[model samples]
Target: MNSSAIAAGPVFSARDITRVYRMGEVSVHALRGVTMDLYRGEFVVLLGPSGSGKSTLLNILGGLDVPTTGSVHFLDQNLTQSTDRELTQFRRDHVGFVFQFYNLIPSLTARENVALVTEIANNPMDPAEALALVGLEARVDHFPAQMSGGEQQRVAIARAVAKRPDVLLCDEPTGALDAKTGIVVLEVIERINRELGTTTAVITHNAMIAEMADRVISLSDGRVSEIRRNERKRPASEIVW
Candidate 1:
């Protein structure tokens, strides 16, 4: 890995971001002055225990949520200053997200699920190509009900990336699967980041997954505790549970 390449300004930069949730009389602080940068074409793993604010930060980066303070700049665009409509367009245009659960429609086949996003994208890949990228070409005609948990999740991943978004934000992507199955899903994600050069960020509690990331960011109590760069990144298949 080239230090100069990593030092080049990040594709996504967050500065002193904070998120507070008000619950009736009490206010819950999810993120306290969190600052970070995600460089272009790098796979980053966000490691944290529950309530560590990893997901909140991911959501804010994906434009699904906003911070209470500070600013987020995706490339040169200031996301914090964008209106709701602009944020919506930003998400559709530049971001792709995958969650722990495979939120595929039961009635839709894998191809149709991916087509849902390609239909609206500006310069989208073909639905079949997207499914192929995730190694799901053979399962394109299968409905979500007919597929295994990992397969359905792959379909979800395909749908997310069909639009060829610059960034892929995954929140606990492998959280619901068994170890072996999770590795399979992780491999697909790794392949996408490698082959498509998508700037990927995955949130996970599993420390083993950090081995596959170019950089591992650990969060504690709504703050970034540490960030470590991997000298030799390991393949996801080599990650032991």
Candidate 2:
């Protein structure tokens, strides 16, 4: 953890958390006694392979899923004990999620796509402001089909951040783009984390991306294998596949 982050305390504290999925007669453990903390304004990367439970843990932290055992605290609120409605409210009020694929509506322009989130948020950035923040001011009127994959992904990012959520949870945010374009998307995310001071956690299989994080947490076979803090974090522009 960063020293500053430690002094501020954690925005999220998860303890002995585990998730078990039952498929017919068999049980699959997605998380095994995962304990972690995400501090305000710090960038952390969850590094893992497929089925390593990074995504599951991210979802749990974002209130998309609850663990079968243990507890998760987002500030003073216990997410594990929240009802479905409370979890929904929790996600709406505090979390911003960016997935691998851009989930923009095809018919909506970039500004309109971002407006969908701002409309429901308690407090939000103007859609145009959010688009500008992601370097998409010129593309605000462009529809999904008019944009490249990277551009569309930026629009997705714009939408997620429009609500000015407390935390930005990204899952393989650049997995679908080429190295050059992926670097661009990462630059946007990095800028947001720095400028907005939104607690950010990104999940990736690419080890090179970990260099940009304040901490790198390695996960394997549903368990956290290692956690290391970066003494000198690199900028996203210097990262490559």
Candidate 3:
């Protein structure tokens, strides 16, 4: 991490970032000169249509991918300038990600799956404690194969938070589940954000979830189309479907 480079301010400061993908003679521009500031302990919801560059922005923020132009400064580390190893280490130390699919190992029990991450974390929480945080204490011994979609997603959240990361990046975490199942998963995520203060950013197509967030950022055509601040965020359970 570069100490002198990171300014004393927001957790993330992205300045005019652009991501371009080439397919032979054709090129795709995902993010076009997008700039933003993401604060710590903030629950932000990103809403956008398909191919609107929302996921691309989240990927850059998570250090899963780099921008072709501009910079992303995370807690003083220039994410766009790090090597593969540095990026990997940075992700291990500073970030946690939850996606649409619950990627729990089928052979491992819930506890063991979560334990896999804790073992590598610098100062990880106990696997059991993480599971308990997501209301899965009794089902810790169950395998991924035995759990429902919602339960599996809860396990994913537990695994992500076990590391006590500074950032939690979720991309359509409830996309694969039904309405009821998705709400349950959302509740778990909200609870984790409130309890752990994990500075969460959740990107989703379901605009209803925006009610539970501290702010909403809407993206269109690779730019921040709108940013709305909520005076008061309702509880996850109270969020209207």
Q: Would you list the clashing residue pairs of candidate 1? A: none
What C-alpha lDDT values do all the predictions have? 0.94, 0.94, 0.89
lDDT of 3 at 229: 83
lDDT (C-alpha) at residue 18 in model 3: 94
Q: Residues 31-51, candidate 3, lDDT per residue (tens digit)?
A: 888988788788899988889
**lDDT (tens digit, per residue) of candidate 2 on 100-211:** 9998999999999999999999989999999999999999999999999999999998999999999999999999999999999999999999999989999999999999
How are the candidates ranked when ordered by lDDT, highest leading? 2, 1, 3
Ranking of all candidate structures by their TM-score, best first: 2, 1, 3
The TM-scores of all predictions, comma-separated, are: 0.98, 0.98, 0.95
- State model 2's lDDT: 0.94
Candidate 1: count the clashes: 0
RMSD of each: 1.0, 0.9, 3.6
Instruction: Count clashes in each candidate, considering only residues at least 3 apart in sequence or on different chains.
Output: 0, 0, 1
TM-score of 2: 0.98
